[model samples]
Every structure is written in C-alpha cells, then in structure tokens.
Target chain A: MTSAFALSDHDSAQLPLATELIAVIVASSGGAARILTIGGGDRLPSGPLESRHRSLQSGLRAWVEAQTRHQLGYMEQLYTFADPDRTGSAPNVRVISVSYLGLTRESQKASFSDAGWRDWYRYFPWEDHRAGAPPLIAAAIAPRLSAWAHGATTAALRRERRQRADITFGLNGHRWNEELALHRYELMFEAGLVEEAHRAGADLRERAGLFGRPMVHDHRRILATGIARLRAKIKYRPVVFELMPDEFTLFQLQQTVESLSGRLLHKQNFRRFIEQQQLVEETGDIATETGGRPAKLFRFRREVRIERAIGGTKLPTPRS
Target chain B: MTSAFALSDHDSAQLPLATELIAVIVASSGGAARILTIGGGDRLPSGPLESRHRSLQSGLRAWVEAQTRHQLGYMEQLYTFADPDRTGSAPNVRVISVSYLGLTRESQKASFSDAGWRDWYRYFPWEDHRAGAPPLIAAAIAPRLSAWAHGATTAALRRERRQRADITFGLNGHRWNEELALHRYELMFEAGLVEEAHRAGADLRERAGLFGRPMVHDHRRILATGIARLRAKIKYRPVVFELMPDEFTLFQLQQTVESLSGRLLHKQNFRRFIEQQQLVEETGDIATETGGRPAKLFRFRREVRIERAIGGTKLPTPRS
Candidate 1:
C-alpha cells in the first residue's frame, strides 16, 4: 500500500517523472466532425522517448504503428517536457516526453483492443457552435455561473468573478471564441466541477454538471489541449489536408473546417481563398450525383506544399 | 547498473507510462526576443506527470515555479507523447508526457546555475525581418541548400530534394515566410551546418557554419518548437499582452509582435484591426519623446478578453 501522504510537498515535488506523447487526430465522420481517440478515451496515440530510436520522428512512427497498426498519414512534433520528481516512487527518476499530432482518414477508424474513439465535443459540449450555442449554455450554465460570480463577498471580488466568468464563458453580448477550450476547462476544474476533483477527494459535481461530462484521469483536459491546437491550426496551415480525403468537393472541405472551428465560413470567400492559394487542383471530375449542382473534385496540390509546408498551405485564415 | 532492455513489442501495447510537460517560455530581454532555458541547456522548461498531482496545470505550475519562481501568464498545453525506450538501455520501462507553452513579461532573469538566455534570432539568422531579410539569406544559405538539393542522384529524388530545399530555405524566387522556423532548423540540422552537431560527435570545423552556436543538448530543437509556436500564436490570440507591461503604446506592442513573428505589419491595417476588435482601451495616459509624435497608452480591454480569448486576437496572416 502507498504510505500515508507519501506525497508531501517535498515528496510531491519529486514525482511526475514520466515523459510521454499525445496526438490529436481529426477527421470528418458521419457528416459530423470527430476527433480521434484510443479505446474510447480522449487520449491520442502516444508512447515514451527511447534512446534506441534514431530521432524523435522515427520513434514516434514506431510506437504509432505498434499501437494502431495503421500507417500515419501525416505527423508533426508538437512539444516536449520532462518531470523533475519522476512519477515513479524512485527518487531522481526523470522522464522526457515528446508529443506529436497526427492525421489519418476516418476509413481507418478501426479500433484497437484497448482503444476506443469518442467525439471531442463530448468532452467540450459548449464548443459545438455550428447550430449556435446550445440551450444548456444559456438556461443552465449562464445563470448558475452568474450566481456563483455574485457569490463573491466584496463588490470588487464580485466584479472580478463576473469578469472571469464572462471571459471563460462568453457573457453579456461577448462572442464566444471557441478556442479558449483549455481555459474554460481550467475554470470549471478550479470551481470543483470536474471529475478529476472527485478522484482527488473534492466534490463539485453540482457545479461540474453545468460544464459537461469529465473524463477519466486528465483525459478531458488533454483533449482540450488538442482541440485548441487544432482550432488555431486550421486557420493558417494546410493541415486540413490531413483530415481530408484524396478527392473532396470544395464544399466538403469547407464544412470540415467549419465543423471543427465551430464557425460557419462565407462560401464565396472560402472558395476564392482556396482557389487563389492553389491549395487544391481540380481533378476535372465532378460529384453531381449526391447534390443539387455538380461540385468539382480537388486534390491537394502536392506543389504549394513546398512553400507553405512550414507556415501553412492556406491563405486567409477563417475570418468572418 | 541500469537495466539493459526496456522495450519490447508487448511492452509497447500498454499506454504510455509517464506524462511529461515541456514549456516554451518567451520574453523580451534588452530589446531582443529571448527564450528561457534551464540546466545550462538549450531551451525551455519541462517536468513529469504524477499521480499525486491534482491535475496537469497544477503539476506544471509546481515544477515551473520551483525553477523560475515566476507565476506563469497565458499558458496553453502544447502536446503530449510517450516513448517507452527513451533511455536506450531500458527496454521494459515506458513513459508518458504532457507539454505546455507559457508566456510572461521578462523580469529579473532566473538564476539557474547552468541556464542562460539567448536571442531567438541568433538561431535562425534569416528570420529577422524587422528590416526584412538580409543579403546573407541569399549569399549564405541559398546556394548551399540549392547545391545539396541538386546533389541527389536520381532525377525524381533530385527534383524533390530541390523543391524541399527551395521552399524550406526560401530559395529561387520564393518569399520567405517567417513562420517556418522549425522547418529551417530541421533543414539546417540535416545539413550538419549548425553548431549543435559539432557539440556532439561531429567535428566543428567540418560543420557548414550555417547559423548560430548550438546548445549542450536538444535545446536547439526545443528552441525551434518554441519559435514555431510563437510564430503561429501571434496571428490569432491576444497573447502579445503577456509580453507587454501592464500599460504600453500601440507602436511598442506592434514592435514586439513583429519581433517575435519576424514579419512587418501594415501599420494602418494593424491599427484598424485592433480598433475594430475593441480589444484595447485607453488608459487615460500618454508617452512621448522618442523623437516622434506622442502616443496614447492603452491597457488591454479586460472585458473584451471575454470576447476573443481564443481566436479573437487576429494575426496579419499575409495573403500577399
């Protein structure tokens, strides 16, 4: 059994030694945008850093193959960090982790035995802005959060609470910027309305209910991290290609972006930007069978890839 | 003695065992954009995941505070991944890690016995677009990378190599996008021109002398991660506030954004965007005497922060 309070501040300071990786794999599925997860958990495919690996990229591919067995379409290193105390009970144990985000087609959604896939919006229900803010956001959360903000003792404190609440959960005519996923999650967590709190022996289920369902461990929070990165990414990079199929109608691609970003795009402008940037070349093939008018199929130009590969392959971030 | 083998295929099936957090802390020091580093290494701060920790944010704050003692502002989890065989000899051991990015105003630099700060431009010399790309870009790197690209034996490979080099290093009638910081570093690293390899087993004199001295470990690589993130960040979020003092002139703020992003902004367009967004408010203050017109001081609108905490801050992503 673990020692009583084996994690004193001094001892606690020495834990968390393992280094790992997390990836956010996004794709369109069932006409709805979905994020990839392993074993129904919000975690993306990840593994540890090993010295045997030639470089970080190779090591990442090896682990990814071993777990999912599907070839990765595209991958990039997101970031890396280390734990001072080493999460293991051993003292001076340090682990270094490097994380990557990968993209694959939903056709490869084959599940791994210990893995499962869940919708990203399940964890961040408020993020689905396609149809506008869900009613629960206004009727359930707004008023409750307002009450909580007013619960502060002094006027200044009350104002500060209101400001924080309003910012984290867009209030008083402030437009909800879908990208503050992590901050919004943190605010809910601090308020003791997250599942991790119950695991940690604190209870804020009543408040947590206003947010959304929490995940096992830090999974929900990690999902927020990936969503924020992806939301910010779609604006400037051609990374949307990774989530797209080889042959896609421009509208299909546009909807995918709109779906993940939780914001609708102006069709003409979106089409004009994509065309001007030369992100896609017309396949000369049209898909008229499924829709009103035939839309041309476009293949991601593997050429602009050269110039935009680093900064991005897209022009005009999705600005309304 | 440490264990000899820590990785096996079966060992890989289990989820990553350790979670690590790497942080890219950026600040302006002495008129130059600088990156924070630790342990006399190349770049950034990092730590591990612990069961004792309440959540990822608290865990990261604990480790970061231990070193810098400065509370972080504007933090976002960057990525997470695990490498089971990171230790080389250890085979069965696995680790998981979560990475994060932190932004803060430069203060009294922390005193890490082995750590020091370096100007970010020193690493990617070509990125300094404050005055636009210097002649050195064409004179120094273009020819070398061009030759290397054409050095491939097969025609197919040669053309690819050429294209990759041209776009990555901005060669042959290409515009330089400052956002490709990581691409630039990786390209140079592969070319064996940077000082980092020389610090390893590679010889110093034989190195291509591309740009900048190298850090002791993978610090340069981590530095690239930070650079790429900042370059992408400036385009969307109001994170520039983190680098600014409590109050500042709009011009000073623009300079900071341009400095980190390595791109010049159309002053009129930038000001218009700022004003229209309602992201800032006059502080009823003014400053003058820099041999130019006196300017009003403004603090970020604490309220509109509720409006665009995520993608509210716009980046002048060049469509030009």
Candidate 2:
C-alpha cells in the first residue's frame, strides 16, 4: 500500500496533464442516420478541455454547440480513454479523452464543408443490416475475416480466431446481434482488416476489400461505442425522439429507428408496440409528403418520462 | 471551438495530476450485508494510485488484498469522479477517483480491528424494507422530510421537493423502488437530512436526528453509487454468487438477495423465479442447518455466463 507521498515523488503538486473531449453527436435526416463530423468527416467532433468549462459534460457540450450551433438534446458520458497509445500524439504527453454520446434533432446548422454530418454507415458499413446484411458483409468482410482467422500461426490460435469471427460477425449460422457494433469493429481491428490496425505498417495493398473509411485516430471506434449504446438504449428508453422532428409520421419514426438500429422492424408489430407503450400521441396534423398516402403526425408524450424512469420504447427485437 | 494548443495557453503540461482509488467491497455474513471499511469503519479502504500498478483495477485489487488479505472477485468500475469538490483534499489538485465495486465471499480474512466489513444498513437504515418499512421512516424520517419539503420558500419548490421525496422514498403512495439507493441518498443530502449536507455548519444541533453515520468524505456517496449499481445489476446478471460460499441452500440464497436488495422477496415466488432462470444447479447436497427441515444446496452454473451475456437471475421483484 503506497502512501500519497510515496506514490508521487515529485512534490505531489505538479505533473503534466491533458484532457480532451470527444463527442459522437448523432442525428437523423432524410431517413438516413448521420453523425456530426469534422476534418472531412474523418474525425468525430472533438476539442480540448478548457478551464472555462465547468465539467466534462459542459466541455463536450460547449465544443459541440460551438461547431454546429445545435443544442445537444441528449448527452451521456460514454467512456474515458487514458491509454498513452490511444492519444495518437507525443508519446510522453498524458492525454485523457472523455467521450460522450450526444443526440439532437436533425438540422442543417453547419455548412457541408467544415463541420457537418456524414452518414454513420460510411464509417461502419458492416453495421447496417437493414438491406439484408448489406452485400459487403458477404462480398468483402466475411472472406477477409475467414482468411484472417485461418492465417493465425498455431492451431489453437486459429480455432480461437475463427470462433471469435463467427461470434462477432454472426457467421456460422449465429444470429446477427445489431447491438454489437463496437465488438464487430474491434474484431475487424484485431484481425488487421481495418485501416486503424495498419496505422504503423501500411504496406498491405490487400486492404482494399477490408477497411471502412477510417477516422483520424480511433474516432470511429468511439463512434461505434456510441452507436452500440444508442442501439441498446433505444430498446429500453424513448431516446429515438431526440433524433426526430417535433412531429413525425409513424413511417418516418420507424425509418429513423431502422436507420439507427440497422434493422428493419415489422411495421404492424412496431405500430402496436408503440401504441401500447403510449410514448407518442397524435398531433392532429398530417404529413402529405409520404409519397403513398397522407399519414398522421405524432409527437412524443413527454409526460410519460415523469411516470417512470425505465420506460421502454418497445422497438421490436430484430428477427434474424 | 478551442484548439487543443490554444486551450492550453497557461502551461497546461504543469497541471497537477492526482489519481485516487475508492473501493466498494461488499459481502454478506450472519444474514446481513456489509461493506469493507477502514479508518474505524468510517471510510472505505482506498489509496493513492501508484505507478507500480499496471492498471487502475490492479491498483484497487492490490490495495484491498493488502488491507484485507482477501482475494477480490467480480470487480467492475462503478463510476469516475473528477469534480474538485469531490476530492475534498485541495482546490487546485486535479484528483480523479475511479471507484470500483468488488465482491468477495464473506470470509474471516480480516479481524474486526483493522480493515473490516460493517453492516451496510448502518449507513442506510431507511433503505431496508425487508420486514416492511423501517420504523425509523415514520418515526424519524417522514416528519423531518415533510418539514423540509414544506420549508421551501416557493410553492413550486415545495411541491417539487415533496414529489422528489415521494418518488425516491416511495411517499404519497408511490411504490418503493429498491434499486434507487443512490437517489434516496441524494434526496436526503439535498434535504439536509444527512451529515454530508452540513459539512460547513455546526450550529444545527437539530441535525443530530437527521444524519446517518458520516463517512470521512464522499465515501458514503460512492457506496450509494455501488449499491445502486448492484441493485440494478443483480436483476440482469448472476453477480450474487460472488458473495456466497461454494454451495448454499435456496433459503440462504434468498436471504442474501433480500439482504443486498433491502427488500423482502416472496418465498415461493422467489423459488419459482430462481428455478425458471436455471442460474444455479443442485449440488446433490442437503444442508441440515435449516431450522425446520433439511434444504437442498445449489451452486452457481458458471457455464451460463458463456452461453449468453444477458443471463437474468430473475429474483422476484419486490412486492411493494
């Protein structure tokens, strides 16, 4: 057991410290889900920890609001990363990046060039299964993952890799769990299929069929973490409204949920589930732009939030 | 948005860094729940983060093992507190206390003199509703809480405080949620009923009847967080075995669950719930320690953990 003084030999008063903020600001627009991005959509909206900020959450909110001029609707601290290797800068510098998941109503608040929204799937192509596992999984990911698993040196290691690939990628007749966005991404990175796994040694030209557009530095990993949290959270909480407008048709609501969860829900079952939960109420208005027929508009019933903390959104479980 | 370099104009490299480890080691013995404590049972066993530790968890494990000579099992990070006020050491010192919740089988590993476990109910008497609401609530707590709620200057504030008390403490006919250990503590603190609320002022002699045994600093708050997490987690995960011996009777198991949750579960319903979950397997052993009749002993099924991530213990929800 080390005393406070023994733990720090340097007067216990001064040490090099740095704190960074990372935000996975997500929104839904035009039936497609997008994430707030900077630097040509290669990095998540992030900034330095300023002294002016009151707390970690405030610092993250300030950074996001300044960039997009959109007030963060729902925000929660996701995780704190402090590994020196994750900093992606000087080796000696100690940087702590506190990541957050923020959701807001879709808005054209920022320009297309600077800080703007990009399709989240563009960075996580394998996560979207709305179109039946997205041909990319079979055409590209599966073969590369199988090869990577087989390329392991020892038999035991090869068997381990194969099992991991099967579980994470939902291969070998396993049910594809839509909530495993981070796990799948991590598996790809571990197999050296993602660009992040080859940051140091980029000599592999065979990476063509593998990598999703890489973020600046593990930002995509953080984004996947946010996506996983959102997917799991929406099932138990009425957080999907954070991505929807003031009033939306059931089809639009279903699309937004499908866009985020990467799974198409059964329309009749979803409608029944929604009605039973009483999470939304008809707004007495109609949306004429449905392209089929005018649909009734509904707004989230905020009063239900006060009745219980664990209100379920009642999104149907994905049928594999 | 502040640039990383621009945000650190005042020689940010020289900022003082301090890392503290707070442990919420819990156990059950003598049909009562306990938490590991040091410093005359006023505070949890904690230490400054040492460089020798490979990681935060290792540091916490090392500290606990050294102090109690008991090996920790089922450890998980509860929460991280970075607020300077939470440190209660120095205003300028940047202290990040990453609290962890550790479960160890109830053991005679440490004497009652040094680092020992104390009944968790001592710090949270009102939380226990096993034999119905504690008399302390109606006798000591309810009147004081009512007075506090009425003392609010504005009517809206009074109504808000009363409503919060109702939800947290299950007043005004609201069902007592056994999982809201943290919320109840916070409400008590906010109402200035707990000792932590009167840190600066000593003039309130009336506060003698209002306080729980005060911990050294924010340790009680940390414990509340751990309790809240455990209460919520036990429903979804089979973590209770960490507190049990290798094999135990169903009654003993039920007692442990009741002790930790601070709520009495229906015997037949709890048995049915446990049996349906298949979280445990009969050990083909009978314990004659039962006062009435010999009871079948069971051990946790470790294989269930690998089979699925979201295994439920299915302890009957408290009939409030």
Candidate 3:
C-alpha cells in the first residue's frame, strides 16, 4: 500500500537532479516586436539552476542580468518541461527546464555585443495579419498542410488533422485567434512542416525555410509560449506598458499594441477606447516626430493598477 | 558565464532527492461541493512520487486510485511548490511538492474507510454569500482582521494591510469577488488569524476558531488554490458537468455551480445565458424530483466543449 505521505529515502544519493532556466525576454522596437537572443540570435538566453540562488525567479533574474546586462521588469513562470525526450536522446537522464516570460522596454544602450534582438514575426510570418493574411499561408503552407492531412493513414486521422489545421491556422474562412501562437507552432511541428520537426526525425528537408526560422533546441516553441501569454495577457492586464516608453504619443502606443498583437486597430475607435479606460493621461507635452501635426504625449496612470481589475482593451476590428 | 544548458553534477549521488504529490480531488454532493481527504480528514490524500510511474500525472492517478479506488475523470496540473519551508521544519532538505486539481463525479460506492468527502465551506465559511454574508464574517473575522491591521508596527503598514483586507474579503463597501478564494485564505494566513499562522510562529492564539478549521499542513492553502481555479474555470470551460449527475433539472445544475462558487446566481438570467450558449439540451424526460413541479431533464451538450471557446457564465448580480 503506497501512502501519499511516505517519506523520501533518507539516502538522497540516487535522485536525478538536472534543472535549467530558459528566458524569453520580449520587447517592442520600431513598430516591430522582438525577443532577446544569445549566441548571435540563434538561441534564447538560458542557464543552469544554480544551487546558491534563493528561488527560481531570482535565479533566472541573476542569470539573465549577467548575460544581457538588461534588467527584466515584468516576469512570470511560463511552463516547466520535464519530458525525457525534451532533453535530447539521453534516456537515463532527467532534466527539468523551467521557462519564464519577461517584458521590458527596448533598450537604446548597448550592453552585450554577442546578444541581439530579432523581430518575432521573422520566425512566424503567417501570424502577422495586420496587412491582411500573409501570402505564404494560402500560397505555400496551407497546400502543404492539406497534403499532410490527406496523407494520414486513416480517413479519421486525415479528417482530424485537417480540422486541427483549419481551427488553429484559421484556414477555410475561420477567423484567426491571435492567442493560438503556440498551438499553430505545435500543429506545424506535428505535420512535419517546421525545421525543428525535421531535427526531431521528420523528413521535412524541403519544407525547411518555407516554414519560418527555427531556434536552437526548442527555444522557438518557448518564444511562441511567451508570445501567446503576452497576447492573451494584454487583453486583460496593463502589461503592454512594460513594453512602452515612459511617455509617448497615442499613435505610438497604438502602434506598439498593433505590432505585438499582429493586428491592425481602427484609429478613431482605438483612441476612444483608450480615453474611456483612462489607462493613460495627457502629459501636456507634444511630439512632432510624426510627419504631420504634433500629437499629445501621454504617460500611464500608475494608480489605475490598484484601483480595480481593469477590463480587457477591445480591439477595433476592421469592417468585413 | 552561465548557460541555460549547463549540466548538473555528473555524480548525481549528492542531489537532494525529495518529491511529493498533493492532490485536490473535488466532487459535488447534494447542493454542496466537497473535497476528498484522508487521515481522518486532517490532510489531503497525498504521497511520495514513486519512481515506477512513467509520468507525474500517471503517478498521481495511480496513487489516488490505489488509495480511494475511484477513477478520476478530468485533471490538470495546478502549480508546483518547491519552497523548502513547505516541507515542514526540516532545514537543508529540498522537497518539491507538485499539486494537482482533479474533477470527478461524486463516488457512488464507498472505497477507503479513512477517506471521505467534506464540504469545502467547512474551511471557508466567509466565502459563501449565497444567503448573504456568512454571519461569522461580520460577527468575528472582520473585527479580528481590523485589530491585526491596527497592531502593525507602522501606520503605512497598517493602512496597506487594511487595504489588502478590504480588497480580498470585500469589506468596507467592496463587492465580493468569488474568484479570490486563495487571496482571502492568504490574507487570513498573513494576519495570523488562521491556525497555520501560529505554527509559522505568529502570536495569534486568541483569534483561532474565529477562522475556519485548519488542515495538518498547507493543505488548506492548496485546497484554496483548487477552489479558486474551479471557480474561474467553470465560467469558460463547462467543467461543472464533472460534478453533476447524468440527468438533472436546470435548477440542480445551477445549484451545483452556486455551491462551488459559494454565491447565488440570478436564476432567470442564468437560464437565459445557458440557453444562449447552447450548453445543454432537453432529454425529453421530466424530472419530478424537483419537488413542486415536474421540470425538464437536460444533459450537457458535450460537443460545445470542442466547437468554440465558451465565454464565462455571467452571475446575475443582486440589485443593491
């Protein structure tokens, strides 16, 4: 009878103790959302869990600061990956990778020359539908996904795969849900359309560059998780400010949100919604950076953070 | 110079090897929701993570079944607590406690003699406002919490604590938020009004029974987490069916939700919302069991689970 309260073996000598931290530090720069990458933009910033650290969050904070020299502002634990297959082909080894999502303003000062930021859309071309659906979706990816679905051994499997592709990628006239970033990535991987899938034993050599850039060792998937979290979080929380400057024009603010969400907002309706929410207040400063007339600069009203659980910001959808 | 991929010590012999599983098995019995417990109802049914199990979820499922002989239907990983202090007074010991929230129909046959179901409200009396505020909150808890806040070392500290109390417990004209179960429990714990606080070296002996019953360890806190998750989930997930019987009147379904959320739903509005969502369908059978009149029996339309992301059910607010 195995009781839920049985004590661990006093010997503690046989435990497989391998743990690491994967950081997904995100920011918005020049109307494009980017993620910080180490190893010359090929990998996410990561490190082992040092025993000397007080807690998981602190461990990640220290490791990231040491590597990039930029402090993380808003951070949350994303997910923990402990699957044996995630740690490569090592069968006997157990490795737990705790991933985190961090937000910070895009830095103007250079700290580490080795690490640089890459636009997130570069790795997920189909996600940005601000200017309408990317041509690659209908021209290339959709046809391949249809082929893969048709190639399934069973009719039921084919149907299921097709439905999954349709729902996740918003194919067949389905409306795209921006929050399904991770789902879309996983679906492409399962269909052997992404580069990472090829590395995982899928014969997808021909489909390599066709399916966006790949990161080293599942880092792209972690970025997708971060993106999905941020996209969903901005709807309810004022976390988007973490990516904004201390003061900026309403146009800049709207552009920042658009760049991150990968969707265009109706200009008039966006301003109306922002004004009603009072998420920001006029700073009495004007910015002439816009090629046209000066726009009022505004700062986030920090007090609103504590006043109430602010409702989600409504995105003004373009008229169909 | 730490990399996210740095490997742990190769010896693996000196690693602190402590792992435990905390279960929050929930069910709805009668009009009240209950959680399963073992050890004469002092602790949540828990055990060590055995090496023989293939995965964490499987380990938990096997252990839970072996103990209660009941099969779980729906399960999700809640959170992982790795704080060493959570493993009791042991210094230098590292015990990682992984908590899970499980949903299943109330068992028809008795399994474990030592384990049984208990109403969740027994440990959270102040949370249920279905019949207006629980009298004990006004009669006892509020005054005690006020005293604790006043006793703070500094006026700023006192004000902050008071604000926290007001926001968490819905005191001082604040509206009650049913989803803040964990926040309320944590506030009580911090104020030292709960028994667990005294164990944590708080000098709060006088205000003991004024709060609800305390569990052996932080099991009550974990239970609070489960309650919070379930309350938030039912709004979007249609998981309430896991707690209900196969065929029930709309009133019975409403009662189950009310019981779990610890609040009253505006009856007519609740029905309207359910109908609009098409969450349930009539079975063409009459349920005379509803007492006064024969109400129609309905079963959940399970297809809606996968068709769309269901919106939260709006609880009809009482006219103040």
Best by DockQ: 3
The residue pairs found clashing in candidate 2 are none
Q: Which stretch of 10 consecutive residues in model 3 chain A shows the poorest summed lDDT?
A: A5-14
lDDT of 2 by residue, A1-320 (tens): 44332445544323355677899999988878999887768787777665566666787788777766667878887877666567566655556677899989767666544678889898888888888888888888889889998898999778777776777778888778787788889888887778887887677644543457887788989999999989888887888877888899998899999999999888888898889888899999999987888999999886665544532244685544
**Could you estimate the TM-score for every candidate?**
0.76, 0.88, 0.91
Model 1 error, position A49 (Å): 6.4
Model 1: per-residue lDDT, tens digit, B142-203?
A: 77667766777898777877776677666776667676788788876666557664554555
* TM-score of decoy 3: 0.91
What does fnat come to for each candidate?
A: 0.22, 0.14, 0.21
Choose 1 or 2, whichever is better by lDDT.
Answer: 2
TM-score of chain A of 3: 0.93
**DockQ for model 2?**
0.31
Tell me the tens digit of each residue's lDDT in model 2 across B18-135: 6778899999876799999887788887775554554567778887776666678889888766775675787777677778999887676665447788899888889889889988
**Model 1 Cα lDDT, one tens digit per residue, A269-304:** 899998877789999999986559788989999877
Docking class of 3: acceptable
Worst 10 residues of 2 chain B by lDDT: B305-314
Please give the CA lDDT of all the candidate structures. 0.65, 0.78, 0.77
